[model samples]
Target chain A: MKHWKKILFWGLAISLGLVISLAPMPVKATSSNQKLFKIQASRFAFSPAVLAVNPGDQVTIELVSQDVVHGLSIDGYDLHLVADPGQTASMTFTAGQAGSYTLRCSETCGAMHPFMVGKLQVGGNDLLWRAAGLALLAVIAGVWWKRV
Target chain B: MFAPGESRLNLARLRVLDKLIKSRWPLLLARSITLAGFVFTILVGLLGSPVGSHNFAIIFVWIAWWTALKLFFIPLGGRSWCSVCPLPMPGEWLQNGSLLTKAQKSIGLGMRWPRRLRGNWLASGLFLLIGIFSALTLTDARLTAWILLGLLGTAMLLSLIFERRAFCSYVCPIGGFTGIYAKTAPLEVRVIDSDICKSHAEKTCYTHCPWGVYPLAMRDSSQCGLCMECLRVCTYDNISLNLRPFGSDLGQTNSITRLDETLLALVMLSSALSFSAVFIGPWGWLKSAAYDVGSTAWWAYTGAYLALSLLVLPGLYTLAVWWSQKTGQAKAPFKRLLADYSQALLPLGLFTWIAFTIDFAFPKFSYVLQVLSDPFGWGWNLVGTSGVSLPSALLGAAPVLQVGAVVVGLFWSANLSQRLVAKQVQPARARRAILPLAGFSLLFSLTMLLLLLG
Candidate 1:
């Protein structure tokens, strides 16, 4: 490979990585209208494994434990609640994230407690597209380096 | 064939490192410390609290040690952990009838290892079996202890039945992947002068190689356990620990092409994907099925897991290799092509494991500290750290780290594929031959990125 080509190749790769790393994340806009969900937590799973909503929605989650004490915590969202058996624990927050965030069981319930998880899809996520584009760029870069 | 820019710097020229490798006491002392820790881990697992987070066995073994192994050891020092692994210590001592000295006579049956059961086939199968049950073992203290005990028992039985670390060479599951990834590590134990080894008639190095590797013929670091036995036994002082560039051994085709190792690579890649889905993905049904051992759902899950690992991933890889062969107009056999190209996945597999470990182990590191103060969760507060709940600040940087790892792995594998194809065909055809495998590697990277960031 030529020296200039190597420099160009690395420069492009670093730039692409930087663009992907520094890309501005789309924030979820707050709205006055509210969306309510009542979720039931059992021994090893939740009632609904996936919750999909549009951006800018004020989401209110009413969590009730069906068996023992369970806690619901969502990553990328500061939403956490603990509910005992037959009791409803509610939390209201704006769903402002435009990606998939993991909803996990916070409390140690049983043997399979660590595996108990759900998904919250806020809106159309662009991170996947950017990642796919970066991968494609890598292949092209590899081919170019080989030819040079 | 070797990489173009590869070079080795011998560490034997350094006085301290040479003395350390030449002497027997340092390695013995290190192994003894690890053995003590291993015994304590087993005891805690058997008698400690059932909670996975609060128990020293689960926290130390699964979180702390696992993280260090994946993140630092394998990449920096090939088979370094195996040098100090305590599982084979009892078996080795029993076989040699000594603790810190060289053996005068064989202690076990000393039967020849069967030729048919050689290679990595058994180790690959054992690795898959362990992976299938890892969901259960990683979370349950009792199960983890039993698994450790089972490994120790198997090692001892094999040592008594065979000779000279046969269990590690043929059947150990961790050894299977460690040997494969060790090729990419920066450290290697090799003959400083091959001519010296060839001219020497006695072949003293072969007699001391516990891993059954011949230093004279060693062109790669895959089979060497880095135990420094050859270093201690070399009469001419020909053995030297050399520092080389990472991925230096990946391009060496002399020792890397094998069907069993190819399958092991594919299995490791597929297993990483499946583990990520089961542990980190937001899917409750998959978790339930994996957790339920004997249920119909679990059976179905197992079926899917086997199909994906043994058939689907290998099938896709075969297709890619066939496409590359057709493009390159190579005359090599299909099996040869499959084996040769599979080496490209080593970097990606290793980095995927590292990325997965970063995601899985980092957030849970607080458990390590928690267990330190109360190893058995008996409210001991030994170190006044029982109430410590140090939240990980690494969550925000995890996605970037994962993406970087995947990208680096993709490029490294791509370079390796290019070199491998060039060795097999014309340089112009090599460019075309590398495309299919490079595409496959890129696709895998994209999939990993999706799993990590999307």
Candidate 2:
């Protein structure tokens, strides 16, 4: 085994790991995009299923319950907002993560309570694209290594 | 260069490990505990809460055991779980008319499995059946119990009618699931020297194997159940519980491939993709359609499910192989190429499942603990822990875990696909051949990443 090649492989692997961890959140935003989303939560469905906001934005979500009691808890954003029937609850947080975070129903709303989900995209789901790049790099590296 | 089994570290060489495997008592004990637990789970499912999370049957079977089976057992031990699988316990005992050892006379008719129904065709069908009804069967406690009961009854019936473990070898979806991915695991049971086994006049190992695997012909870990019966009955002391490199059986030049096994691999891939979409995905319409059995929505869901698994996914894979053949200008038949290149799907499928299990079970892990205190969910807190639930185990780390797992799988698959192509074509042609598979794998990995994180 070539020590330099081994070092290169580990370096590439570590780079991929770093890319996955920090891909979604890129360099600190120079300009912030502020946006407010009023999402309707009803019967295991979220209105405007995909909410897109740029990174470094003051994102405020006004969660309105059309029926029953529901909660909005973003996976990356720890703040959770709950709304009773016909009521609205709001949560404001800085959109720091750039990946797609699932907004799940924190409270049991119905039979499909466990699966109540919506997507929160801050900037873009750059992880997917970065992952794709790393995947190709991996294949190329593998082929090159196997040949050598 | 080390030969396949030659490179393997023989665990059976250690006296304690050898003794544990050679003795019948250890296996019997494991089977008994799982069997009793299985029976109890059935009873509880019949007489338990309608809510899925509170029900022991749903929690343990779908979330707990299913998660463990994918994330731990299959990755670590191959068919190690099958060694102590409880569904075959009673039937196997009846077949041999003995609990611990093989009887002089057996009860089964000793008939052969139908040749047409052999291979993974039946197993794939059985797996699709489970996949299509997964919503109802996974959630409803009574339905879950009935499915287990049905599988038990079928295993017993098959054991009585056929020679040995025919259901597991041919019909059990979980068996097919394990058997197909077992090649990726590090642990394998192989003959130390095939010549030794062939020379021995009394091949007691073959007769004793419940899976009917002749150790001499065991080229891979795909068929052997890791039962250890061969180890005990090997008069020549030829059987070796070899710990080899992970995925040591994959992409082998001498390995045999078949259309049936290839289809099984595709079915597994499709199942993982479909499951990720349905179970962990935020699509309410899909979940509702899947759960509402016999409804119009469900019919549509079934159609989409079947089409995804049967037509779309398999069609893409076939196209990849066709592309590989066309580009490489290989002389092998298209059908043969399909079988050979399909090895790329195994690592991808296995890791996809591990990621899916992580997403599906992380939040519901609380259900496992909650049910432990109240198996029947009749407001009985036997351990004073009922209604207590923990937060999601991985929390925000799940996406990271999911992404990491998928990337590793894609890398492995890419590596394997290149080697598989190189086995046939010249280096230049191999490069062209590998492109399509790499593209296919990369595309699939992105889709999964999108589902998991995007």
Candidate 3:
């Protein structure tokens, strides 16, 4: 190969690597796992799927995915973590807004993938929350294989 | 001594027929595996739901099968997939459902008038579109699954409406790419006895070509689907699957005209660029934004990316050829000569594909594979790893094998180009042909850049 071609090849390779590695890391937003929450990252169920946390409260989500890999992504927040089998990835993010938030699985699981979801009803009456939890649990248990 | 209208079986055709009759086990195995894989891919895409991560597996299957056919079988079998492709099953059965004995071969749809549009161009264009689509929606499992089902459906519809294998010949992009790339394949179906074919009457081989490619046109061996319909139907039985030199029959007679050759070269380069932008470009942020914001801008970005990827590279390549010829003091007629030799770039494109597999397909060096698959999660997963870390032995072996394959592929292409040039150039002044060879080298360099960057 000619000298110019070799130079061009190496230049492109080096620059690409530098760009990927040198890109600034994302800023860490306020998180309350000081407000601890067990994120059951299993197939078909998010154990304790409904969580009601006050605004500015930092929440820690401990992730577990039973089958394949699952991702815990709460849109509009910085809780994007992939939960692998037998491995739990924890992400800490605060509930900065006081609106109803959706917790959706970022990674693809089989069949009803789009429907694998949970809801975080922020600053609601505690009584209505309990009833929704009971119903969500029944659906989860029907799909979940784990006895607990 | 020739009987006027009587058909006779000759030794060459007899050999091919006897092989086809006896090779049922291999044929059956090939059909069963390909059909099962095709069915399984579609089912998984539809029922299980496709996601971004699983698209890699789909790509793996698609690229692996394509590579296997183009690199190894094209030279060997000659459109052998047609004999065994599962796509034709639904159409054939629909035309002659279940009652095998009563069903006639003709569905009585009379021949449609030959339109000015050629089938090969359509087939190639369609394949190019699919390839671009696959790369863009790489992560969308559902989309991948839908594309698979859609392609199969299109093939069935076309086959049902048109006579013979028009779907395979004209519409399916994969088949089109295969037909072109197969030119470089070393194995070909050939007449074992020339004397036998010349003497035989009632030309069954010419008439029964399932893809409707005339046997006389077998000089352009790249286009032969190797469906073996001619072999099966020939009374003379004169064809044999012979191991010939790569591109041997491609240069024998011209099928792809100069203009067509230039268009194909453009298609190949643009497709490669389009693929690379996703895998290697700075569009990662935009891609993430699409998923996050669900903005309409994502769609526009994707469209622009594809247009640039599939169209720009080839356009630039043709422009370069024109510029090079003009500056090289070559006139319009000489420029046309350069364009004719551009068909030689087909091998260069195939070489790019080989290099791509070497760079991207090899699992050990692929960082993305480590992030996605959890191999130990499944008892005996065909794809995936126990850990992200590579085993030295495996990693060492893969790149070595891949580079070796790339080197071998380059040499194969170079040899093919030489033969093609020899055929295109006038016999007396053949030695003076230099400009196109330089163009080929430049294209090859660009391919290497794309591979490395990929």
DockQ-based CAPRI category assigned to the predicted complex of candidate 3: incorrect
Model 1 chain B lowest lDDT segment of ten: B389-398
Task: Show the lowest summed lDDT stretch of 10 residues, model 3 chain A.
Answer: A139-148
> What RMSD, rounded to one decimal, does every model reach?
2.8, 2.7, 17.1
> How much is B218 displaced in model 2, in angstroms?
0.7
Model 3 spans > 4 angstroms off: A1-148, B1-29, B52-60, B63-78, B95-105, B108-110, B193-201, B252-258, B280-283, B286-311, B320-339, B364-393, B396-433, B450-454
| lDDT per residue (tens digit) for residues B198-262 in model 2 | 78987898888899998888777888899899989887787788888899989875445588888
| Candidate achieving higher TM-score, 1 or 2 | 1
- Looking at candidate 2, what is the lDDT of residue A61? 89
Using lDDT as the yardstick, the better of models 2 and 3 is 2
Local distance difference test scores for all models: 0.81, 0.84, 0.52
DockQ metric, candidate 3: 0.02
Docking class of 2: acceptable
> How many clashes in each candidate?
1, 0, 27
- Residues B208-281 of candidate 1 have per-residue lDDT tens digits of 77877898787778788899988888888778788888988777655345898898888889888888888877
Estimate the TM-score for candidate 1: 0.93
Instruction: Quote each prediction's TM-score.
Output: 0.93, 0.93, 0.62
